[model samples]
Target chain A: MSDHKFTRRIFLSGAVVTVTALSLTGCTEPKTQLVKIEQAGAFFNPDDLTLLNDIAEIMIPRTGTPGAADAQVAAVIDAMMMTWANGATRDLFSNTLQKIELMAETLKGKPYSSLTLKQRQSLISEIDVRAFSDEVPDYAEGYKRLKDLIFRVFYSSEAANADYVPIPGQYRGNLTLDEYESLTEAYSYGG
Target chain B: MADEFDVIVVGSGVTGGWAAKEFCEKGFKTLVLERGRHLDHPDPEYTDMLAPWEAENAGLMPESFEDAGRYSMLRKKGRLYKSQWARFFVDDKEYPYSFPKDRPFMWTRGYQLGGRSITWGRQSYRWSAKDFEANAKDGNGVPWPIGYDDLAPWYDYVEAFAGISGAKDDVETLPNGDFLKPWEMSCAEQFVSDNLKKNRPDRPMVIGRCANLSEVRPIHTELGRGPCQARNMCKQGCSFGAYFCSLSSTLPAAERTGNLTIVTDAIVTSVLYDDKKGRATGVSVVDRKTKCLRKYKAKVVFLCASALGSVQVMLNSRSDARPKGIANSSGLLGCYIMDHFGGAGATGVVPGFEDRYSFGRRPTGIYMPSFRHEKADDVDFVRGYGYQGGGSTRPRTSHTGKKVGIGAAVKEHVGKALPWRMRLIMYGEMLPYIDNRASLHPVKTDDWGMPLLHIDAYGRDNEKKMLVQAAKDAEDILIAGGCINVKSSHVNPENHIELGSRTHEMGGACMGSDPKNSVLNKWCQAHDVPNLFVTDGASMSSCSTQNPSLTYMALTARATDHAAKLLKEGVL
Candidate 1:
């Protein structure tokens, strides 16, 4: 299995790099090269990529199980946008990303990527309040769609199946509710 | 040139397959006509075997297909799940329909050999004595010419062949059929069932009886099929043929008889009625692929072209004897439509039981049989509905706690989540009203120049009241069972059954004792044309809440046998 690894420095840099220098020497084929950025991953704007990585890490940081970054959620989202999503879904995602960037620029005079952890947290909290409120209809709708898509892409990834949600081999219909609950909870928690 | 055949049965769906099978098996050469293309069973185009990671859209319907207008009603019914398996069944561009501006009908349908049987929910239930006697007692719609006893033996015959897996829940209202071992329920489901039974002694919750073969019988095994893998991917068309479908079961059986001749893409335009013989001689068919018109001869003609599809053919077949439409003596031929008004129920989170876990995904749910018609005292609605529900643990959600902090709190939150529970669903009855009817489109014509069906139907006041009450009753039961966060929602009245969408769509050419009241006789033969038989949903007198496929199968079986007997006795 390919190791889906990303570093903070490599993510921040706009230039794409390979894990091994041998591929750079032209001895190996481009398709065979491991640890290269996926096509879907390439769609993420360099600045937006950094912000997404940072926010996802905050949402589901590295624990005993792999986090959102480890699941390649950004790549999934990028693929979803390019292939599956229609015009409206793509617009919704792009608009939300732009809103986050603009909000960060207004608060700190810098991109969301350049913001401190504390500054990012405060900005997100403010956005969350507005997003969750019934008064802010547009933001609420956007947030719900954004939140659902993010989770759908992340948890449904192969990474989550291996380390997070374990697929059972057989169905035993007589198991108790508590038993089902614990297993599901554990699966959700990336056990 | 009009192609000739010994027998031509319109619509290669559930009823069509049965009629074809019976005729073929009896050593009579038969030609099966279908409006749609052929879909091979076992290796059908859409099978949900692909993993989530492998899927292009991860089960979200593509907007392009939705925009094509063929799936207008289908999109609302959760049929638009965008996956690898979606392409085979969902084709919105080729098949389309137009509804009234004020009344929108979601005609959720697929035109193929197996028809909607390829993607049916497979919940099988028997109609009791009450369902058979409903129209007779109520006097609302035409009374069923035949009673439960006439269909009982046929039900056993079909069940034995189809391999219905269910437990015999000895309820008088819901008669038990020939069943295989019932599929097991989850621990949470068992607890809820036990508590509900003990508390509410009137209502009994039994395991859902489905057409899926839990354990393969010798008959099924002889046909080269095996037991179900418990994958719960039935909507994609089971590759193993563990579930019953026209492609997987009847069509194959007919093929083995060597008397069945299936001609795909042959759209039946009208039944050629012989005025002198006072019978349908054959059918005029148009090749959907080649745009060529042809005629076929047959001793007996069966119109199993769905409910509305059959009605369309009947209404299109104009003769001097019947000017309004074929066998339109009563004018009740295209009236009194009925469907199970679905999407009424309450869901809630279970309070306890955190220790139990289940293994594989069981395909079926627990069914709460009808408690309304136990002893008919005054209820708001005339007919009652049954609840088909089950309990399940909550799956993962994508809510990130403390949105902007890359810390241990986020890690901790993702590590220890709790499992929540919810109910399956309930479907109530929509009373058969004369006003709720299907008629030929005034201006619209299909791709083949056949008149399109203009279905303007809705649930009546009684149906709305039944749904409202049923929703409340479901909520009360869940709350009484110590459930939290109980929420109830009613599906839009316009959305229920899509008018002719359920594929269980019944009663356009209903059966009655008198020729002035119904289109087909008790034997499913048209009253005006002796040799013409309408054995599909159009022959149903009333629409019971139970999945109507099994009943259609039984009725078709009985009708074919009766037709054969009548033919041999020189009655025609």
Candidate 2:
């Protein structure tokens, strides 16, 4: 009240006119949730979200660039395991996606999204080149945790927001990478 | 008009924005206060224009939700948890404090309105007469009655209005200012600064002086601020006020000297001390959104509230003529509590620049300064250790658990730049421990019931043998500079040491000629309340190794110009 000039639209219109002028003077207190609902809770299972969105579209399929299922990265890994996985990282990412559907029904049979995209990219390159930390195995740590959570949601989407330069309007710092790609514009090489 | 008048300034930060811009440009009538909430500088709660794939937890923040698990202790601090600079830091569960679980300090706070000078690490440097003659030449606790030619003209008047950016190089252990044009360094930091100066010619390096404008003057384009477009996105605040914060340079020059005011959720919580006008006759605050209590008055108060938050407002200011708090009649207000022993160092890989890269994002790094200082103590430690870090022709965070590889060649190898690599880190100099103190928690109390402080502080045994000889002398200067697969930090003796992970906190009301062992004197005033001053990082008499907010803005502009020339000689 001592004029700090903030804005979340003047704080939800001054908290909805102070809770509608304290409920039109019927004054009942205990109200406060000033907005923050978002909880629907699901963290996979519609057949492990259709085998983790068909193994995140064969590790980012669409080629002319926009991959990881064109960036809907399994709905940001189901909203980061329903608001950021906690219970021991949602039980170690649900026992590594149920050991990648029991290692695709004991080595490529019925489910890991019913194989064949060249045998699911050669069993995701042999369960992602094995040995993925915390001492491996859980279908080699769920193909290295769903391939590092679909490369951290396709390197932060909007189809990897054209490798930022943010407010990099200018700042030379001694060029020459062909004078920094002929002065500016040429960075997007990934991540 | 604001209950307080000729000078109040409890803590808007960076020593209450240089004592409310030198007490409102010498005409006084200032106020300031701010225990969080107002944040204006490019404020839309600045996420330095987001884009690192704008949020949905991209810039980081997923330690399992609930507002990022209420900032899991600032996600163990490193680069202050960046999911949009963790919503401008501070909130140890509604500002609680306490310490000592086998010595674990981590008291990092940020509390808005430019506090924590909007998440610091603006690394400024300067402090030199061998860091004010190393605490009276290593007896080690109280000395600094002002040195480096009494702060080289207040660090050339706050680096000519806070611009800095480096490359001066006079370097007698970092002492050169009024800079501006610098930020270059990365042909793999000029080949590890010419192979660590052909092997340690007293450890040279340079570059990172910082604060950032990299050329701006016209008094910073008449103070609207610009330059620093390096866009390393300064903990998401700078919006081209290109660095030097406290709402981009001294509370907008004390809001263009119309004799400042500020307030914002107030909260000072102590310093009134009247007892027959012995002096400090103001401040009691509270509101932080209606926890109520008020007070104000003033003739001069200051206490830039940090470094154990102005000794937790002079230990919750109880009275009875200094009952262990207020001017603290040298019960040395909260003993000596300090900070900077930093998480040690290392990292490697610098082979060849691969055709010289790095064109911008140079938000600084490449300092080195300490070189085991104090006329080369040569170990058994007393004070030294600098080496900040640099060289990254790329490959640092390919994000989450070192991503192996997948899709379009891992999105063109995580937007490229993985060849050179470097790092350094170190920090050191912690000494000050009179049982590394900071008191208060007689029983905890917080969320505005106040009293939680308690912090104990640690890092002794001369800061664990200077963080294991500054991490094996930063892996022997990254394998003597051509760096290979180096690596360091993991210094043991059974590890531990997380105390305030380098938020660079400082002493607890220190300064002393001898107000019976100190609680502000060598002009940080209040030998026992003469108008009660306290230039922040609370009067730091010792914790030296540079970067202590450019000596708390040259000791709050040389103690608010000696309390505005003793308030025009009426003697404060």
Candidate 3:
């Protein structure tokens, strides 16, 4: 598949696709939908999809709510990389994933896909901490971009967030936190 | 033989809709011509109901499409081009206008049946008395033929029909209209407004008066219009008919009268004037798709094709009787170009609103009315500006702020909302300058063989100075109102501001008391051609900081009333 331009049909349901096999021990069952990863498109291979799926789950692991993987964040990112993102954004996303693989090899002496669940969690946690610190690393900015996209897509999805109301009938300017939280669904506006 | 009607309204926008409605209701056969393709009410193209994830690329256009030169003007504004609503804007490559290489003017346009009203920022306000008298007092332009009093009842007339929602705030400069119940401000906004009232009472921040229906009335519901759902996605076109647009409100009302006829893809090239009768005979039109030339005869014509659009038509209508253009007796048909200049603002975090959140989107925010009614030592400009912005609770996620947290902790953090961040963007009045003008390009022509409009206008020293003061004042006001990390942004040092970027282009065919200096008189009737009227933004004497569409509607209502009366009396 080319890095740019995937007709909606080819991107959504066509091409060699697989549901991410989250077989890691102690991993929670994906309560929402499974992420459909294409074989290759905009800098992702089959192995890279596995690594990304694991990373997304570790970042927003299911508790009482659905996690990033559950929300099909990886699938959305793949589509965005091909269609929505520019060359710069695609490059950053690719570079960030490559850096994660290099770090796994450097620290754990193995590929990120081959690492144990505990090892993957510890390494990603360390990277996340270092990404936001004062002494910025080379991988910091790119990693943040990837992480931001994951969180953005996950939160915006109906699978992850139940508060996405399409048409809010009224506007109340100062609803108290207690009153807001008591509602089944929350209200929001603007980007 | 040409298609005959009592009235021909060119451009089915805000003003055109009002013009058609009034004339049709008054028992006149009105024909409305639109240059763009027809779009029905509750247009299927509206993406308002789509959720973020459901929308294409999550409400983002492809980077390649956005980078195209056609949307370069849209990129400067930064909101429309990147969003799903980008389709509403014209592709500049297809319908082009030019300006000086050094002086760029962003003429943001939406040329469908509803025109730019589909994508208009619906903050409607009536221009104050101070606004009318400022031009004459400051000697920037000619005196306004009509004042606030002349347009007051007309404002009431339009507001009652349009269903404006606003507070009757006692700010004389920003007059209150006959309104529906007002939208409320957020906790942080109220806190800042209350603080400002204590500190600077003269500059009290009040709820923005807007066209969104807070409560649907009989007048609105009679035409299938409903109350605003507060989606805040009005630019995508409201299927609810909640917020006002020509397709939703006025055109439907006009259609109900059975005296209205609409023809889309009919581009009016020029007004056809009769030398012997000394009046406009009809209009020359070209089919947008087929390039088929045609004529339409009418007893009267109202040019509501925006400021630049109407002026371009008049400037192209050259003849032996009036070679300067149709209503060129004043020789000011395409002069005195103006738009509200705004590239200044302040934004900061409101410290104590974390415990409060708003439900749904209010279509508009609070406005700080212009305080500089007259000259002062502190004020460096002849006219003033207003702020149209509000506070919103910032979204919290794993990557918010300095930290990009991981694991279950990140999800919990994302669940809670962050403190409110308030933004205040200032839009200042642009003084009418005869030097800042638009004319037909001698060499260039569009596919339809109409001359491309050549605009030569930019923000001046006065506008730049106003922005500087506006930024400083915004920072000061926010800091005094307990906002943290206040930062101000102003115009670029090299290029002060983009004139037409705000989409408030006004004063190309200005109204004035003296027939020698203006194209249109008080009734928006052309001085040379009594049967022709230019009632859109082109007829504006001055560009006020307040949104101009409301005034355009009021003027159209008022002008058509006069035209229908004259027609009845056999004055033509």
Candidate 4:
């Protein structure tokens, strides 16, 4: 109940901000503009953000469900980078992504954007296999982290198309199968 | 305002909070002084308000040796990670102490109005008659002046007030409390409990007796506290006031009395001893920020600045009446230190509970009471040990090898529940030795300019023996409880000598009948100075096999009541 109220307020205030911004500008000069979802973190640099967004779009392409890029997963991850990563972690994450991008280009035998859809998917799947292995190869460790982060961000984003309720009253110690199935479950591992 | 009050409670943690509440409610103008920052009933510093994804640290502190080397013991435990709530943990560089070279003591200090109470494992258990009698029977440490009978009433009082969550067990070792409501055991845990009951009746496994209120009573509602939401993010400071931390419970109650005055950032240096009156007048406090000195007078004083922290105060105070320090007549002030002997146990899979799992975190575990010399087949060790562990089913996520599955197979495996595993950690009693003591550091000084505590403590032969016995017994118990793939035992050379890492440090100003051997009396008061008290972990004469905070709260309440009565009777 309260979750809906808070989200509604957020949407209202967001709309107000957009209106105020548009009114203040008054002139449409659509040139040399850089777009960003969250400008708070180390990953907010446009180059890194664009690369992460492209990687996410390839991983979770729009089918029936909203894609990773559609949910702004990269922007969220970028914001989280500031809170989560120290210098060492930040370097590890960025360096690993760069290595993966190079590997993917080499595997496809072409630049990322110019590659066929099948070739791009094939490269992702190949990386996914190495990433999901029992003991991740030292080379695959960065891609593994990147893949895990993608899934984590995607599930927690608006793309999941799930409802939320704050203060989930009195946790049930024992829930029958029927009761669980009967209820409209909106599961989240807390944003 | 007035610098004088009827009672002055130093170190507003568990005991200090209780002291304030008890004294204030009794119509005594009580001043509760906290050395750290102020915190109110509704915690503003809680990480529970932040979602896990929102907090990139996942409401935990990541392992960072660079954060402060002092948290070396805790940093590995992902639960203690850096986030909004890690602020509760003191930065070790600012407040450093020295321990023995061989023995690495991990002293985690929670420096806030609530102190370590905010971060403590809420496991609340009453020490049984066996626990109280062990020291006296074994002839290791000084005999407890008061026993379970003396403390039974106070335990009931604190349990009711604190709103303990536990089931009534007719068992002798683990006595039941006046619990509001008991948290239910998981299917796997229940299986283990039932199996233990049927096969090994001597080993009773029950739901952990904890201070988190399973159900709220009107009294708790009056104190602006509610029931445990079972979110299990309590270490972040319970935003709901569900757990009985000093901030959520006692301090708030003290505030409600309108007779309580709380002064935060007041680092108490020493007790101001009076020569003529043979009493403690008040305390000398330095401003935590400005480093300015100030004095406050009270008819009675309670020292609840933790175990070693209180000892620093006693050793710092210098007076003509008792030259060594206030009430240090015997020169036995910083002696006979004790902590729960840990670092030995067992872990294994209870294969039968494969079909069972639990929902929502219990935030507590099963407690196996001490076997010691109680049974017919007794161990060679003097004191006993108890196993505090839990049996839970979690998704099978441990996979590490050169060859492994990928894609859908790995995803499916990572998302499913693994077999139930029973992990147990044995806590044996550490026998007190006079050599294992904490005194003032010779030259080193903290930010407050007070002498840093030099804790020279080590595990002895008896503790090593206890660990060995505990390991063997834990293995036996696990196998008997129908466990498979058992790692026979978990005793190690490094953990055996873990000095103060358990953070259950007790003694120094221990309570005893004889003033020659101990610092405090039966009422937890200074043997020489009646008006002064040390009701925190410092007053523990013997280290029992359970968590000691519940005992500390009871002792604080009992001492304040006694002091109030004595003050009314016109006694010094």
Per DockQ, the best of the predicted structures is 3
| Candidate 2's TM-score on the B chain | 0.36
* lDDT (C-alpha) at residue B393 in model 4: 31
- Per-residue accuracy of model 1 over A1-191 as CA lDDT, tens digit each: 23343221011011222221111101111332212232225355544554555455555555776667677666555655555566887777767778888877986687675566667666766776667666674555655676666566666666666633323323575456566556555554345
**What would the C-alpha RMSD of candidate 4 be, to one decimal place?**
5.9
lDDT of 1 by residue, B183-211 (tens): 88766677667777778767777888989
Q: Tens digits of per-residue lDDT for model 4 on B1-572?
A: 89999989998888998999999899999998899998765654665765544443333333243443645545644456455456677766667887767766667788889999898899999998887787688787788999899899999999999989898987787777778767787666677788888889989888888988888888898888888876677887887889999998998888888999999999999999778878899999999999999999999989999998898899889755555667888787888888886788898787654544455567678889886745334655577789898764343553212233333333333335577788889887888888888888889899889988888887888788777777788888877877777775655644537666677999998888899888899999999898999999889988888899999999999998899999899894
Sort order, DockQ high to low = 3, 1, 2, 4
lDDT of each: 0.71, 0.72, 0.83, 0.73
Error of 3 at B411 (Å): 4.3
Under CAPRI classification, how is model 2 graded? Answer: incorrect
Question: Which ten residues in a row are the worst by lDDT in model 4 chain B?
Answer: B399-408
**Residue A14 deviation, candidate 2, in Å?**
36
What fraction of the real A-B contacts shows up in model 4?
0.14
Better of 2 and 3 by DockQ: 3
Tens digit per residue, CA lDDT, model 3, B1-572: 23999999999989999999999999999999999989998987776876666656655566766555656787667778645677778877789998989888889988789998899999899999998899888999878999999999999999999999999997899887779999988888888888888887877888888999999999999989999998888998898999889999899999989999999999999999989888998899999999999999999999999999999999999977677799888889889999987889999888886677777778998888887768789876788888888874445533442456788766677655777888999989988889889999989999999999999987888887888899998998888777899999987735746788788999988998788999899999998899999999999999878889999999999999999999999996
Deviation in Å, model 4, residue B32 alpha carbon: 0.4
* DockQ-based class of model 3: acceptable
In model 2 chain B, where is the ten-residue run with the lowest total lDDT? B392-401
